[model samples]
Target: MNIVIIGGGGFLGQKLARALVARGTLNGTAISRITLADVNDPAGIEGASLPVETARCDITDPASVARVVTGETDVIYHLAAVVSAHAEEEFEDGMQINLFGTLNILERCRKLGTAPLMVFTSSIAVYGGEVPDPITETSLLNPQTSYGAQKAAGELLVNDYSRKGYVDGRGVRLPTISIRPGKPNRAASSFMSSILREPLNGQAANCPVGEDFLHYYLSPRKCVENLIRTAEIPAADLGRNRILQMPGRTLSIRQMIDAMSAVAGPEPARLITWQPDEAISSIVAGWRFDIHADRALALGLAADASFEENVRYYIEDDRPGN
Candidate 1:
């Protein structure tokens, strides 16, 4: 099977590529060729067990996207986007990358005339505007932020393309992935990582949200695992529902601090200070606090046990030094 990853140089994208290379195949599907495409030229992988290719293309440009998808691509994982906070700040850039970029891919897939499966990485931000606890797959999307709006629109486009038999598409709504490695990006949820990442390295971090503020979370490892499983699952199992919510555990900001305290001790916990930002809080307040991913679980997709497990995995695996 030939597979293509759109944002293969990003944090999640790199991990997904490594995992695929490690497995050598997915569900008995022989991965003969893997293509990594991004605006930034990706570094070539050495000692790869499977054949891999790299392409520098702007996903927002239909011509560029079409050029890369000319071959026999059995599956495509669309992970390219400007992210939440940056999208909110740069409205035009967000629309071009998040909304139009997805359209470009779907359009190219349609023109390919081959029924290749597509897995889109959507954000939980898609569900906003008075969401109940344990939000279901059927929950209405009332996004307040521009980023959420773009993602919700993309989900609709994916569904429309799937219904037209242009492509087999699956959209998974991801939660805030905590303890992410590397410098923080512009995501409002970056504070989620900051609270843990800085303290683990014996540095300080700001807690934008209050202790009682509850939010959903998943580890990067689990996120990638879910994406792979979604790609391999039979189409018949997917049925009419082309979109599914990923599994995640809900915890308050305080619970996260407690987890850090248990792992890194009280010193790191003390480093955390409350300093609210209206912009971030306003955007995050609309986000769904919890979700019941019955469809994902039925399809054999699983998540980490708790927030503590998510943090522990990051420390052990990424091992960010102070």
Candidate 2:
């Protein structure tokens, strides 16, 4: 069967591509073709066991989006988005890509006239205004940021389209994936991973949030695992509910540094510079991400055991080389 990863050039997207290539299949179907579509083609990785089709398509353009989906597509993993800070800075870009891009896919799937399984990567950003102590599946969507607003709206659209039988869609609200393997981007939460990753790589990093600030986190490995699981879950089991809130653990920035110190020694932890940015601090504070995702837990999706486990996972899997 043919499958497509909408943001395949991205860090998490590329990792997911590698994981799919390693597995050689999705659910029970042998993957016949895997399309990697993004603004730029994913570098270095071509399919090892199967053919990997890399397409440079703009999600904001309906014609460009049409090139990616076809009747042969049995599954689609939508990871494309204009992240938080950037979205807040460029409203129109975010609206076009994050909101309309999703609509475009749903419309295309509708035209296909086949119910294909489409998995979307929503974010913890969906929850903001006065949230439950432990964020649950039923919490209201009161987003404070443009990025969150777009995702919340997109989630609704995905659910509505699924209800209309346009596609068998599943939207998973992902937590902040920690220790992402890459350089810092414009995301305000970039420091969340960078504080650990940059220091581990022997570069100094800025800690934007306070030591006491707490947020939910998942590992890159678990993120990919859960995405694959989302694709595999049967539609009948999900009923009318199209969205799944992913599981994550809450920890403070201090706890993360402590975990890093425990894993790699004092040197890595020492490289952090506490330079707070008011805008970033405000955005992070506006977010309420304390997740207790029972639905995902029942489906066998789990968070990384601890902050140290995530740090250690990066050391083992993404460190320079084997």
Candidate 3:
């Protein structure tokens, strides 16, 4: 099987690449070659049994996106995006990359006519405004942020494109990926990772929301696992709607801090100081932090056992020193 990961330079993308290399197959088919395409060449990948090619391709440029995704490709993992806060601050860039760039990929697959499996990484931000207690598969979308709006739009395209038989598209609405290994980026939920990541690394990180703030979360490990599992799912089973809400744990900020403290000691947890930002709070307040994800669970997707397990996994698999 030949696979292409669009945001391969990013943390989750790189992790998925390494996992694929280690597993050596997808859906029981031996992975012949894997291409990691991004605006910059993906790094830290080496010494794999299979060929792992790195390509520099900008998704916004249709020609560039075309070069990486072709008819010969068996599966495509679309992880590229402008992210939340960045997209909110830069509307034009967000629209260009999040919306148009996605269009470019779908169009390319449509032209291929091979109907390659396209796994799109969407976000929990898609749900907002008068959300139910446990946001389910049947919830109505009312995106409140530019980033949310863009992702919601992408999900619609994925569904429509699949219905049209232009592509075998599967959209997984990802929860806030917490305990991320790297430094913070422009995502409004960056604090979700930073609070734990920085503290564990012996650095201080500010909490942008109060301790009571809640959100759905997934570990980097489970996120990649589900991405691969999504690729393996047969189209016949998906029926008409080609989207699944990826399962995740719902926890408040306090719960996460308590977990961190339990694993890494109170010293690390003490490094987190609450200094709420109104803009960040407002953006996050509208999101549905609790979700049932019945479809994903039924489809064999799973969430992390607990927030504590998430911390431990991060320390073992992606801690800076480790």
List, residue by residue over 95-174, the lDDT tens digit for candidate 3.
99999999999999998899889999998888888766768888888888888899999999999999998988999999
Q: How do the predictions measure up, each by TM-score? A: 0.94, 0.96, 0.96
Candidate 1 residue-wise lDDT, 268-288, digit = tens: 888777788898898677677
Error of 2 at 189 (Å): 0.8
What's the residue-level lDDT of 276 in candidate 2?
Answer: 82
> Model 1 RMSD to the real structure?
1.8
lDDT of 3: 0.90
Every candidate's lDDT: 0.85, 0.87, 0.90
Best model per lDDT: 3
Number of colliding residue pairs in model 1:
0
**Which runs of model 2 end up more than 4 angstroms from their true locations?**
none
**Whose lDDT is higher: candidate 2's or candidate 3's?**
3
Least well predicted 10-residue stretch by lDDT in candidate 1: 313-322
> Cα deviation in Å at residue 55, candidate 1?
1.3
lDDT of 2 by residue, 1-322 (tens): 8899999888888888888889988888888888899987665365378888889878878788889988888899999998988888899999999999999988999988987889999998988887667778888888888999999999999999999999999999999989888788888788899999989998999998789999889899989999998888888778777899888888999998999999999998889999889988987786776678898888777888888899899998786663
